[model samples]
Target: MFSYCTDPDTLSGFSWLSCYLTTGKHMAFYRAFGTVLLLLAITAPTALAFGFCGARAARSQVAPLRWFGKIYIAIVRGVPDIAFFLFFVIALDQAFEWLRHQVKCPDWDEPIRQGNDFVVCQIAKMPLGNAPQWVHETYGFFLAILTFAIVFGAFAANILYGAMNTVPHAQMETAEAYGMNRKQAFWRVMVPQMWVYALPGLSNLWMVLIKATPLLFLLGVEDIVYWARELGGSKTARFSDYPHPDWRMWYFLALLVFYLGFTKVSEVVLDRLMTRLTRGQATMGGEAQRKAAA
Candidate 1:
């Protein structure tokens, strides 16, 4: 917004473009890019934590825990991720509201599921109906995060399970022979050793997670994709100050470049992490590192 921006009809070329890009809506659009990054930053660690727990459950001595873990991993992998993303957001939202309804409205006679509608008490409405706009947005984002974690956690569990198995049986046996308990063996020998094997699968999962960020729009989160579509659509004089032709193609191109750059940076970082993890291990990479050092 400069004085020239006051007369858009006369402004053209780079001047018009500069004024257009500096609009308040465009600022929001730019912030949405940061939201995407925030989602990834939050979801990655949360999903990994879920995966670690699921993987541990799958390997648990208790039969029921193992069965539950196995079922979670299997069912999620069997379904399309988009399907899960759609289903889980609704299901989880309802589950939370239902629990809240029970606690907050104990005397309510109406069933939560009256035919197809998921009815809940006013108190149980997510964001409480009276909450601020930011609260609603935050709740949607939280749901998206949960959905992402649930879906990707299963894949991570599978990867970690295989990695755990790849840890040498001899290593565990030696740990036990040294009077280490099963937990100790797992913590000291198996867990650390499995990282080298798991890194490749986990790295791929990270890339998948990055690409899947676009699905945040489906979850009702104001993610970058949502902003891109909203801002890139053809605007009219009646609706916007900066009306233009269809620009979705260019917006999507920007998203593509952003993701490519993100993935490239992740690859570089993960490669370095893998190199660090492989050191002093008995794997091929570790052996190679040792030889090179020698």
Candidate 2:
């Protein structure tokens, strides 16, 4: 804010605009962009790890493990993402609190589920009653990350499983012929080769994940979308120093430009990654690269 920001009545044009953009709420709006970026950075890798585990489990020699992985993939991929987001957050939150309640209040004679209310001991609360604002926000963000990971991870698992199968059987046989065991062949041969096949699907998944960041508002994270809607709504002179007509359309347009630009950058990066992964390999992409170089 500027020193002249103290008197909004006399401020006009660029002066008013600068002061408006530098308000406490506007600073929060700026920070919300970072929140979205951080969510993507953290969730992408965590989701990939989850998918890797699920994919490996689906292909496991043990029937129980394989069945578990198949069921997980089927259930998650089949469910609507919005429905999953709504249901899973509450379920996961309650599950955590319930576990904590059992440990922290072993002698309590009350049932956790009393009609519609799910009650827990104060100490068992996720952030606790006395916890600071950041702790509550962090807890909500953590839940959002987990929910996003579980949903996206299932789709990633399916993509990876198919990619693993697309690697030629002869490659595995050759590894075995060279005295490598199944695990060694998998890690050294199949896994390395699968990325070329998997990249396209994973790239699309990444885009979907980017679009899905708005769902953070549903989980109470006060993300970019939340801030945009809040700040863009019409504010009256009675409510605050700055008053304006509804500007939600402009705010949403800004969001549109942001997502479009972000996706464009992502496409460029993924293309380069695909090119690097395909070079010198046996796939069609590699074959094309070879011909181009020649």
Quantify all predictions' global Cα lDDT against the true fold. 0.90, 0.93
Q: Tens digit of lDDT per residue, candidate 2, span 68-143?
A: 9998889875567899999989999999999999999999889888999999989999989999998998999999
Off by over 4 Å in 2: none
lDDT of 1 by residue, 32-111 (tens): 88898899999999999889999999999999999999987898755678999999998999899988998999999988
Task: Supply candidate 1's per-residue lDDT for 171.
Answer: 89
TM-score top scorer: 2
Best model number under lDDT: 2
